[model samples]
Target: MLFTQAKGRNVIALTTAESLATVTGIAIAPAPARIAAVRVKTRGPGTQVTWNDVHSFGPDAVTVRTPDTIQGDQDTTAPTDKHHDPIGKRLLTETGQNLGSLDDIDFDETTGHIKRLIMAGQDIPGERLLGAGTYAIAVAAP
Candidate 1:
């Protein structure tokens, strides 16, 4: 059994099922290999997601880089100054009121764009708050 390291955190196998077998040792099997580029695609607080390796043996793994955090584009005005945190620690109402804190955010699967902002509220609305799509979210802090 032999292995080679590619890029920064990837391993290239030199035998049939080698990569898949290696991955299986840790968890599940790997997907077939394809010639393409590897990228993180998108990132948020506590999480750094990866996209189709274009060269991996599995359907990209959304590795959890950190915990208790969310990711979104900055430069857009939040409900308030508190809503201008990278990890989203504050929650603002459409009427300029502090409702609760931000728990996490969700994104569109295929596009890797923001979908919703999960707030840490209880009696206000659903556990999962809705978003106005990426256009509504900017990577800038308020």
Candidate 2:
């Protein structure tokens, strides 16, 4: 699913099917290129859970093993210092070629792996993603 579309999905517990929070954002880590954590809105400051804690990423909701899986905001930091925001970051190639601006990321919710990168008129495969910094998202040249 598109990360953008999954933003509002409910975060629930698998055993009880209880809704814990609403998905607000996702933090991704580069290098291996996978989701590091899922940020959500709870009654408190905020909450997040690591990808390993995620039991399933279904169409309706994301499931976790238990409520204990959720972590407070203090434990959830930026996926990395360089990549703060996933949406609207400028896109650039490793060779310094400009692609465009990032629109949304196509990711496999279950595995937390990116599948594609969406832009104005191009849909670049996720494997092309190299890294992202505050300034721009870098992709490898084809």
How many residue pairs clash in each candidate at the backbone level? 13, 0
Residue 91 error, candidate 1, Å: 1.4
Question: Scored by Cα lDDT, where does model 1 land?
Answer: 0.27
Give the worst 10-residue stretch by lDDT in candidate 2: 76-85
Kindly report which residue stretches of model 1 are placed more than 4 angstroms away from their true locations once superposed. 1-85, 122-142
What candidate 2 gets wrong by more than 4 Å, as runs, is 73-83
Clashing pairs in 2: none
**TM-score for candidate 2:** 0.84
Quantify all predictions' global Cα lDDT against the true fold.
0.27, 0.81
lDDT per residue as tens, model 2, 3-101: 888888999888787888988876766766777888788775547888888999988888998888888756655452224667888889999999889
Candidate number of the best lDDT: 2
